[model samples]
Target: MPFLISPVLTPGALARTPQPTLPTGDGLLLRPWRAEDAPAVHAAFQDRLIHQWHVRSCDSVEEAAGWIAQWQQAWKDESQVQWAVVDEETDELLGRVALRQILLGDGVAEVAYWTVARSRGRGVAFRATTTLTHWAFEEIGFHRLELFHATANEASCRVAAKAGFTLEGTKRSALLHPDGWHDMHFHARVHGD
Candidate 1:
């Protein structure tokens, strides 16, 4: 049985290639996660906002290492791809950006990211997200990318707008946070946009 349309991106398209490191032109690079970066990951999670938005925290370096391992496996499985945003010069961890919930046949995925406490307010998230969005559309052939965040997350709204994702709408109590269900703002960008 043949389908009317082929997958926009083949299964091996990502797994066959080593994930490339992307430079943000603002002193940061998005690279693959490394075991040695576990400590930094653990530290970043300790920030209340990061933990609250992400809904999980690394209790120790070991747990962070486990997360790194999962990220690697996700790449191999072609289910998701993540990058550690780091300083270009010192190679210090600054944040993270990822394309998650990918649907290859549909040519879509969700964008997610967070900046470390010190990296906040400096446009790190916007730059990293824009870089990943470009790679997703130009390099991987994805047609649509979606970004959703709590309506209360003003910072994320700014980043989404800065990265050129158009506001779609808001979902009523779409996601559950530690405190309770929160309305979510839906934003998206397509291949041309």
Candidate 2:
């Protein structure tokens, strides 16, 4: 029995999946990231807060372009899904939201988001998160979606609550920040929740 083994990845294991355009609310939409959006993404990540929490910083346009490319490859790898939150009227970038760490076999995902500096306090993150939450639960058929944030990130915590993601608990020193490790608060929305 100890000698017997099974394959973890079989033939046709990973497939390229279609990306979707989702409408959050009030003329806001979540669309697939485009190469053209790299400039805006670069500008948005310039904020200190974004770097404080998001670790990965798109310091330049080239890095931003690479970021988008990596996300595209992630989609093909069936590992993550991402979107650029935009204003439907002006087509201006508001923020970015993503369901990463996707475990398809277990039907689990982690939602994360950030607003452009100019879009902060406008509920851009909240609306996008709320809309994405529903989509992940119903349309995408995921059993559970979770959102985790540093305990010090009050804004993100508020957004998660407003999006109907219940706070599960805190993981002590689970995230390593630039300054030090952080205790991350966990929030989740399960199917039928």
RMSD in Å for all candidates: 0.9, 3.6
The TM-score that candidate 1 achieves is 0.97
**Per-residue lDDT value at 64 in model 2:** 94
Q: Over the stretch 149-193, how does candidate 1's per-residue lDDT look in tens digits?
A: 999999999999999999999999898889899999999999998
Q: What alpha-carbon RMSD in Å does predicted model 2 have with respect to the real structure?
A: 3.6
Model 2 whole-model lDDT (C-alpha atoms): 0.86
Q: Write the residue-wise lDDT of candidate 2 on 132-170 in tens digits.
A: 888877776778899999999999999999988999999
Q: What ranges in model 2 sit over 4 Å off?
A: 1-17
